[model samples]
Target: VTFLCLPPVSFLLLPHALALWACTRSCPSRCTCTQEKSCSVLCDRINMADLPKEFPCEASSINLDKNNLKFLSERAFGTLPSLKSLSLDHNNISFITPGAFKGLPNLVELKMAHNEYIRYLHTRTFTSLKRLVRLDLSDCNLFSMPDRIFIEQTALKELLCFQNNFRRVPGAIRGMENLTHVYLERNRIEAVAYNSLLGLTSLKYLNLQENRINVIHDEAFKDLQQLENFYLNDNLLAELPKQAFKGLSRLKMLNLGGNLLTNVSKTWFSDLVELEVLYLDRNQLCFIEEGAFENLTSLITLHLNSNNLTALPFSVFQPIYFIGRLYLFRNPWECDCSLEWLKEWMENYKLVRDIPCASPSSVAGLDLSEVVYARLNGTCVDPAELNLTTALPDNPTTENKFNILISKLLQQELKEDLVNSTESFRNGTLLDPAESQVSGGYNGFSTGRALLVLLSMYLIQAETGPH
Candidate 1:
């Protein structure tokens, strides 16, 4: 209380200004430093040759994207003890030492995507980040991943690695117990191992669309019991194995458009009772089996455009009465009389949206709603319509005359056979043309017409007897 010596007001402010200057000096070069009472380092277009040794990011996040950062020290994030999020994306980072992220245990999100040169990643790089939730390495020019890249981060939920050149999904993701979503679309994946996703029980959505998956081994998705949306569009899938979607009891939407499927079997998708939307456009399918969608009673929307189909299987859509929309355009639909049933069913159900034609060969000027399938029921006209009758060289008569003469001979033979055989034409038990007044009954074609033809043929044969 007795010592009250004051140097000056400016002398007290000088030390505060010096402390702020020290925070700025510790930040890396080519980065903007913001200071209020705390310091934050924001780097834009910065050359990340090395991490600043004295950088003090104990109270703020850091942005270090779009740089020519080639390498990082083993403990590059050692000084950022309180950094919440770190962005080192779109850089030329090719190599990282064994322990790149040695510190910064509080990091929540890390974005290192779209870096063409950052092809390699070490497994233990994120070992110290216990609280890391979202890890995005998308579009990073990565061809493969270490098996145990995320084995230590059991708390990770979302992993986004889409738009990359991965030959297969990382094999080490089997230990992610709490993982929810995995996005790996637009890659070059050919095969997916069954045990590759062994431990992801809580996974909900998996997007493997726009890939080069030529084959889907049986039980490829055996462990993904909770998966909902599975997209496999724009691939080279020619056929689906029976067990392809075996364990996906909750799948909702499936897009199989733009593939090379020729035939679809009922058993291939019989277990997906909860499927709603199915896209089958732009394929080579010609015939859809009758019971293909029998078990999928919950289906609402079905797309079948741009295919090689001539006819829909009989009773294919009869069981799926709950469907709302069906797309059948741009297909070679055979619009014959057999389509009468389809037209009637369509009219009954009022399914008019899926009635467009892709070409003139099927429905050129006729309206699908106005036209009835009964008009196209008959086959081509009979060959008798053409005058191409030939005379048997041995018999020397036209087929029509020969047929009549053969009929008379058959009648005479029948009469002789009845007389010689135990069965007699005299009894009422026999079929007799004389006793029956009903023409065309069990005896002949037309009532009087067939009798006259047979009688005239017999008269001619009687006039020219043995010859």
Candidate 2:
């Protein structure tokens, strides 16, 4: 070999030049690499049919998104021991051989979303990813998964499997106690069986929205005691068991919009004392029994819009003290004396949407806020004065007769109180004591006493009704 002489400065730069050469050689053609902190390779949208033969040994992240890759061979990426993240989104990958991710012991996240052709995965495809914290398999055509595929992923916390063809919640996630979030929206699931979500005790957020689910077993979510936000909107649920939500004590936000629910029951929410925001819009609801929402003491936002409601009992919303937003638009409201209390309540909470009248031709198409009280010509006849033997429904069930009696009694009591208050005001006996030194302060006090009596009677009647 011929001897070569160089400036002294060349020796000082030699190590860096060698390193640059090695980096360049390791980086595949049409791919970009950054050496900051550690190597991060980007091979997105390269139209490649296979993974590059070589990648930097120190690579911490690799992006192979939007490529033509169809298969992942065994030990395909085993050389990148330091890899922490790998993204293969928007590929046509349909198969992943076992041991393909074997050597990546430190991998923390893997995104394989939008791989539409991937209908199945090998049982051991992710067996070595013990430290994985997130795995996104969304937008795949997957209908099922092996039950033990995720047995070794002890540290996984979030799983995104939305937009798939699954007919139910995957049984593979049953024993994943560390899992906190699971997104299974936009699937073809038809129901939630009791064992579907049995063992995920640590789950906090669960999204089953936009599915075809129509039935839910009473104990389907009994294991999710820690769940905070639960989404079941846009399903086909027409009814639920009395204890359908019994174990969700810590739940906050609940979405039940876009369903076929026709009525609301008090026992359905007996255990949801901590619930805050509730969505019941876009349903077929026409009736909500008195005290239906009495247990929702922490409720803040309520959605009842886009339903078939004609009237609602004021007592239904009396227990919720923190209510701020109330959605009541797009409903066929009868702007009668029954809804006068709603107007008064709306004035106190201006966030409530305007109610549009659908009956009583005079107020038809008019906003409830603009209708004068005199326009509400609906009358509430006192049931105590009527001949119950003739006025009551013939051949009625005990439950039906009890419900009718309670409704008429409540209406009569409300009407009498309103009439008394109006008469006192007109007679100058209802003036504020501090402003006018009125000697009839007793009148105002009597009104309060009457309300308490009415509430007590209602509660007593409710307690004695059918279970």
Candidate 3:
């Protein structure tokens, strides 16, 4: 009796359930809909060159992607008042006229990606959708666009111009005030002109990572005060100007890896106060001046692996209060008493791994982490020269003169020890420029070291002259 009564009620509800499904699935011919609320035409490879004559006017999202439509004319969307999204991805569209989407005032998202032929667009093509938030125009092979194409997209937050044929930072992004993330990687951008990024004050993430960027003007990043993450790796950047990163005070992660940067200037990182991670790996870095990282109070991780650093100044790491992870692998570290200060500092430091020595063949493959100060002190030990057994002078003035002589001798030895160490890479053995180019690594460095040793030794000898 219960089953029989349930069927009667079920039969009555079958039409209502069908109606609900029909609201999204009742698509017009050559198209599908989910009960008329959303619809998609099965236009992929169907050779349907034109849009279906009728689209559900009340549908919120209509997927017209993968169609063979070639061009978009004025009023092409025919006053779509309720159409909030339209996808034309993978289509063969070539051009868009002014007022092409004349009536899409409430539209929020428009995806026109993968349309390789859609290169030409009028400045007013997107003028109808003032409420547009996300626009994906990537992979369109567009060489250029009118500067004002995105002037009205004030609320746009994400603009993907990735893998396009842009010659530089597109003029369209200059005015998109609310943008927070911009991906312009792998474009043909060669230079970052001054004030090119001026209007994007609200941007937080900028990736110019894989372009032909060789020059960055001093004022290139002056307006990006709020920018946090910046990626500038894999470019032709040879040198960074002093004011290149002038206004990016809030940047956290700066990736300068994979370039031809030879020196780390003291002023390079003076402004990045909130920075935590800095990547200077995979570069041709040869020298880092003392006090280079003194201002980076918040830096926790620094990567200097795979560089040409042979000896680091003992006091260079003094300014950093906390460094949890430091990578100095693959560099030629000359192990000797020159490392005495570093050994003492490392004992107190947290990380004790991956630091290897590349010099003094006996310890070539040894990890510097295991070596102690006692072992390092052995190589630089010198015999005491002052003979304490000698009779003291009876004159008080004579005694004071003897003490002064000993002081100068000790100071001279200390200076000579530092200059003699191969850690400085100044082995005055430098060959002629032509020959040094052929014998660069060890021979060229040894030549420079020889010259520095001669000059420093002369100075030391003069200080203890005729003692």
Candidate 4:
């Protein structure tokens, strides 16, 4: 009976062994395959024009980076039925066929960054990645985004398209219900449309920094019920759309620094009941409307440094209830009668001690916390003669030149003050004795220069006589 073992069973074993040996030798230099219930393949930088048709990747992850692959055919990736994660970063991939991600249903993360040749992604290219949570398309040289680029990526939670070349935020992106974080910074967007952000109800953090956005529509952010952090810094915006941030009920931080705004009213932030931190530094704002921030009761930090403001309204700080710090330096705040309101408010507020001016001549080194507003009314007065007028040509020009020169001289002085502030805060001397030296040196030099220029002009007039 042992000698009679069936020849048919023995004949089938020969071909099975040969088939297994063929798969192993197909790409001995680039891929590895191991049989453990299901075969898996590992290929790093294969640089093939197309995926190997016979590669058995039933349960595997493929990494193909730093390759010269320029296009992906429609069914190229569909063959990798079990690929869970794909890394095609740093490739020269320029074109992807429609429905490129159709076969990648189990993909969790897809990184396509640094592929500078890819400019536009078709609407349904990523529709098959229903389980994808992280999609990084940053630095891809994308100049314009299609309206339906995210139409089918319903499960997407994080989308990073930073450092692209979009001149305007695309009309697409209206329906990402589960998206939590979106990074669109460092682009060329000039205007944001209202319909562009209509249906994103679960967004929490959105970064729009370093763009060229000049206008933001009022209804652009209407339904964001859970938004917390929004960044719009480093743009060319001259003004906000009055109700630009109307419906961000859960917003906590907003950055509007590095813009061209010249003024803002208290009502501008009246609806942000939950806003905490606001950055308004480095703008052309000459004034803040008296009640512009009255509604931001939850605000903790306010930055208003490096502006062209001449005075602060009397009731500017009346609405803030819990401000931990207020930055009012680096602006041309005239220490005059018009600034009495700010002086009074600072006297009543406990956190008014940290306000330091970039120019000693501008803020006079008065510790706003120690100086009573009533006393400051008489002490920090600017005489009527200092009032600028067009008729005072030589004087105004000379005065401006003096200010510019002295501003440059005191550049390092301001940095030293900021440094000392940290050291003093640590040593229990938040305000040290050296603060008293802020005055006299800078102010006297400016005043004496103006007087000397005025006297010299008079002498020149006497010698030259009337024109």
Off by over 4 Å in 2: 1-25, 375-467
Task: Choose the strongest candidate by lDDT.
Answer: 2
Stretch of 10 with least lDDT, candidate 2:
381-390
- Note the clash tally of each candidate: 3, 0, 26, 6
What tens digits encode model 2's per-residue C-alpha lDDT throughout 149-198?
A: 99899899999999999998998999799999999999999999989998
| Cα distance off (Å), candidate 4, residue 417 | 36
TM-score of each: 0.69, 0.76, 0.71, 0.67
After superposition, candidate 1 runs with Cα above 4 Å error: 1-41, 45-56, 338-354, 358-362, 365-367, 370-467
Worst-scoring 10-residue span by lDDT in model 3: 381-390
- Full ranking by lDDT: 2, 3, 1, 4
Question: Candidate 3: where is the Cα deviation over 4 Å?
Answer: 1-26, 35-48, 65-69, 340-352, 370-467
> Across residues 1-467, which tens digit of lDDT does each residue of candidate 4 receive?
24243234455575554434434554335667654434445665667555555554454556666667788778666555666667778888888888776777788888888899999788767767878888888889999878877776788898888999988766666778898998899988888888767778999999999999988887788877789999999999998877778767689999999999988866567678898999999999987777788888899999988889766756775677688888877776555555656656677765554443222243455443333221211353332221121112233344454453344334434445565552323255333233533533433233334554566676557557899
Backbone steric clashes in candidate 4, count: 6
Measured with C-alpha atoms, the lDDT of residue 428 in candidate 2 is 40
Q: In candidate 2, how many Å is residue 400 off?
A: 42
lDDT of every predicted structure (CA atoms): 0.71, 0.82, 0.72, 0.69
TM-score of 3: 0.71
Measured on C-alpha atoms, candidate 3 has an lDDT of 0.72
* Model 1 vs. true fold: TM: 0.69
Best to worst by TM-score, what's the order?
Answer: 2, 3, 1, 4
User: Higher-lDDT candidate among 2 and 3?
Assistant: 2
